[model samples]
Target: MNHNVILTCAVTGAGDTTAKSPHVPVTPKQIADDCIAAARAGASVAHIHVRDPETGTISHSVEHFREVMQRVREADVDIVMNITAGGGGDWIPDAADPTRGGPGSDIQTPRQRHEPVGELLPELCTLDCGSLNFGDMVYVNPADWLREHARLVQAAGVKPELECFDLGHVWFARQLQQEGLIDGDPLYQLCLGIPWGAEADTETLLAMRNRLPHDAHWAAFGIGRHQMPMAAQAVLLGGHARVGLEDNLYLEKGVLATNAQLVEKAASLFENLGARVMTPAETRAHLALRDPNTGHVVEKAIETTAGGAA
Candidate 1:
């Protein structure tokens, strides 16, 4: 089992979770505050995805990301901000014409999806390695587009948390490394329990982990009821942990959870498993997170200051 653990809190995902949970952050201010509260509660990193303030829908607005960054900086909390660069790729075929996209379909070019990551310049952003069947819709990420996205993220000096939903995605990620598109030790996020992807279980997570590059740093998370158990499995196998409302909505059987509560629960669980929950500073060092604009390794993990808005 890994003793030193990095706990990442994926705050609000670009999913249809807001309507199900009252605690899901919709506005930029709410998202920012949740990030701060999560950091204060022992999350090493905050995985962020902005939402449309008026409608509580997923958004790829750079300005929204900018506002969240501004608020977090103003709060003086030390959480590694890992933005989501995996949006704008939902495909629901039109009933009238199967060749065309439907009303819920929202596919974008690699450049479109990379817009927020490029502008925000977060230390880390996710790069979904390949496409998969996402519930009723197909999340499309073609090989050419993935290659382009990886190159763009590398050029920006931002570390990519390679999100692998299956074993093949991990293979393609390695191919990217072979093609010299990836920089530094590749970081992987094994996303499990999503509709038609990798199953959320011990064997599945282990199989995925065993295939990762020996030098790579990886984490894994399961959805809904499997969140905590999968986290334990990941940590026990020497990988890190990711937990939050993005993957799970409940703290227990019937209790809905806030982002902070989820982070708190994960931290507590990791500690109880004989692993120390790493601080943001420690996580940066572990991942070698860098500042894209400054061209500097961000080694400073946490700072002591009065708490800001939560």
Candidate 2:
């Protein structure tokens, strides 16, 4: 029943989805352009992930990140940038030798994973709370690693968007809050519908939401076909919504869609449900997020029913 909501468009994810849809952005300019387009289409934040332009494979290069950041920053549109700090955790053991990593294994130290976020200084960064069976491979984010990642985000003075893929992750996120590792008011993203993780259904979403901190500002999203439905559900359950090419690549059955199209559809749903999509400035004040580039608080108090709901 929350009337005010923040819509985030995840431009591109670190998945093998580029070939599946022609609309999926791969190059730095494409990613940045989509970020701007999504903002114009009503998304307040852009959750970004870079990829190798030539191969369309996920990349962690600071050079790629810099190009994308520079384009988005120099753009005239105002969009809150949220960089992923959850990379370098993909581990696939080799079939021939279980002791060695397979072709898809992409693991890095905690600092290596946080390097881009640390150097780029985006307004928000993600911290995956726990390890989970991510489809055929296992995505590892052990307790120790998570603790260290949280500390790194805290030290950067950027908001950590605690990404909880399961109910246990929600519990661990609360633990991080208790341990004082997460700074400022807790900001969480209830990541649903990933393989072997939480299901993308009302029962699961409500169960996870019930366990969140009472005052936490949170958003939720579902992958693939459940994307728009879960976004509408999030609004009904008093939370913000996220949509983009990252989680879904279609406007309808057999229809390819761009990031802006996805955000526009989500915004339509929000308005139809009696909720107004929040702008970047409003989200900044509502979440008390900092300016990543300038390293200063970006809050502007305004009078509205949804001003401080989260």
For candidate 2, the clash count comes to 0
lDDT of each: 0.87, 0.88
Query: Can you write out model 2's per-residue Cα lDDT over 1-310, one digit (the tens) per residue?
Result: 6788889999999999998998899999999999989988988999999999999998999888888889988988888889998999998999999888999999988999999998988888889999999999999899999999889989988889999999999999999999999876788899999999999999999888888887677789999999999999988887888999999889999999999999989998888988999889888877777865566787656332221221
User: What would the TM-scores of all predictions be?
Assistant: 0.94, 0.96
Candidate 2 Cα errors over 4 Å, as ranges: 292-294, 300-310
Model 1 misplacement above 4 A = 291-295, 298-310
Best by lDDT: 2
lDDT for 287 in candidate 2 is 78
Cα distance off (Å), candidate 2, residue 232: 0.5
In model 1, state the lDDT of residue 130: 95
lDDT of model number 2: 0.88
